[model samples]
Structures are given as C-alpha cells and as structure tokens.
Target: MWSYVGKKSNPRWLWHAIDHRSGKVLAYVFGRRKDEVFLQLKELLEPFGISRFYTDGWGAYERHLEALKHEVGKQNMQKIESKHINLRTRIKRLVRKTICFSKTIQMHDIVIGLFINRYEFEVSI
Candidate 1:
C-alpha cells in the first residue's frame, strides 16, 4: 500500500506477504514501489516455504514470483486488503489526508513496525 512521509508527494509503499490459511503476516518491508523493494519482501518470505501467492496484478509480482504459483485478482486478495483496512484504522499515519502522520521515513516505519509486532505478531518489542 502507498503512504506519504514528510509531504504528500513523498510516497512510500508497504509490501507484505501473509499466509492465506492462518491470516498471519509472514513478512513486511517498507520502501518505494519498485522491483528492488518487492525483491526484498520476497527474500524475506523465502524461509516460509510459500507455495502459492495471491496478489493484485502488480508488475513486480509477475516478474518475481513463479507463474504457476501466482494468482492475481481482488477476490483472492480479500484477506490482505482487509488487513490493510484494519491497519489504516489502527495506525492513523496510514490514513490519507490525516493530520496524524510521521514527519520522517524512519519514524513512519518504526511506528508501523511496532504496531505490527505488538498486535499482529503478539510480540512485546
């Protein structure tokens, strides 16, 4: 998903992979919406042994993930999309046109990272 830091023009993308069965986040990365950033998320998911991937029709996913294991459509991606909604609700920084926003990229990632670790993963850190 796309979020802004410092200003509306400065965009950053949150890339995450979640397990369909458990509805648990496998890994996440924050960066520009580019192939390199997608590759970084993919690398993080390598250890999870993910066989199938359901995602939107993003060019990077098509280029990086195996064709046979990739499925593109909104229908199959409902869980992740719902997760995004919940994230935006809980993390005000993710909401568009909000007064609550991080002034720096470092702070943006740190706040979201803490939320995910505490709530999503049930980790104290």
Candidate 2:
C-alpha cells in the first residue's frame, strides 16, 4: 500500500506479505513501488518457507515469483486487502486524506512498523 511522507506527490509504498490462512502480516519493507523494494520484502520472508503467494497482478511479483508459487488475482487476496483496510482506518497516516501525515521517511516507516508489530504480531516492543 502507498502512503507519503510530507506530501502526496512523494509516495512511499509499504510492500508486505501476509500469511494467507491467518491473514496476518509476515514481513514488510518501505520504499518506492519498485522491484527492489518487493525483493527486500521477499528476502525477509525467505525464512518462512512460503510455498504459495496470492497477490495482485503486480509486475514485480510476476517478475520475481515463480509461476508455480505465485497466483495473481484479487480473489485470492481478500484477506490481505482487508488487513490493508484495517490499517488505513486505525493509522491516521495511512488514511488517504491530508488530516494526518508523517514528515519524514524514517518516522513513516517506524510508526507503521510499530503499529503492525504491536497490533497484529503482538510483539512487545
């Protein structure tokens, strides 16, 4: 998902993966919506031994994930999408309005990361 630091024109994407069955975020990386960013998230997920990836038809996923492992369609992505909605609602910075915004990339990532870690993963930080 995309949010911005300082302004709407400067977009920073939150590239993340979720456990398909549990609908919980597994790993995430923050950067521009580029293949390198997605690759970083993929690297973070390597230890989990993920056998399948259900995702939107993003070009980065198409280029990186193998056909046998990746399934591209919204139908298979409902859980992740719902998680995104929950995030946008709970975190003001992620909402698609100017009411609240982060001023720095570091803060943007840190806040969102903390929220996910605390809320979804139940990690004590």
Candidate 3:
C-alpha cells in the first residue's frame, strides 16, 4: 500500500510478504514501488527459504521471482489483503500520532518499523 509524505504525488509504498500457511507478516519494506524496493523485501525473506510466492501480477515479482516459484493473481492473497486492512484501520485508530501523519520518510519508516517489530513479531527493538 502507498502513503504520501507532504503530498499525494510523492507516494511511498509499503511492500509486504505474508506467510501463506500462518498468514503472518514475514517482512515489509518502505520505499518506492520499484523493483529495487521489492528486491529489498525479497532479500529480507531469503532466510525463510520461501518455496512459492503469490503476488498481484506486479512486474517486479515477475521480473525477479522465477516463473515456477512465482504465481500471479490474487488467488491466495486474501491474508495479505486482510493484513492491509488491519494496518490501515488499527494504525489509524491506535496511532493517531506523528507516525501515521509523518511528513518525513525517516520518521515514517522508523515508527512503523518499531510498531511492526513490537506487535507483529512479538519482539522489542
């Protein structure tokens, strides 16, 4: 999903990877919705040894993930989609602070990363 820093035209995307079986967020990265950004998220997921990937036919996924390992369409993306809703609703409701209303990229990533690390992964960092 995308959010703007100061203006709508400058969108920063939150790329996520969800565990298919558990429906838990494995990792996420905040940056432009470009291949390099997606690559960063993919790199973070390397240790999981993910066998297959499901995406909404995003070009970056197709370009990086092999055809056999990658599946297009929203066939098994419901969990991830649900997570999106939760992030939007819960954050907006719970953190009506500078985090959600961030005007800078550094603050945006730091706050959201902290929240995700603490709540999503059950760890404090």
| CA lDDT of each prediction against the hidden true structure | 0.90, 0.90, 0.81
Better of 1 and 3 by TM-score: 1
> What TM-score, over all chains together, does every model reach?
0.96, 0.95, 0.89
- What TM-score, to 2 decimals, does candidate 2 have? 0.95
Clashing pairs in 2: none
Give stretches of model 1 more than 4 Å off.
Answer: none
Ranking under TM-score, best-scoring first? Answer: 1, 2, 3
Instruction: Kindly list the per-residue Cα lDDT of model 3 for residues 27-49, writing each as its tens digit.
Output: 99999989999899999999999
Where does candidate 2 stray beyond 4 Å? none
Q: Give the TM-score of candidate 3.
A: 0.89
Ranking under lDDT, best-scoring first? 1, 2, 3
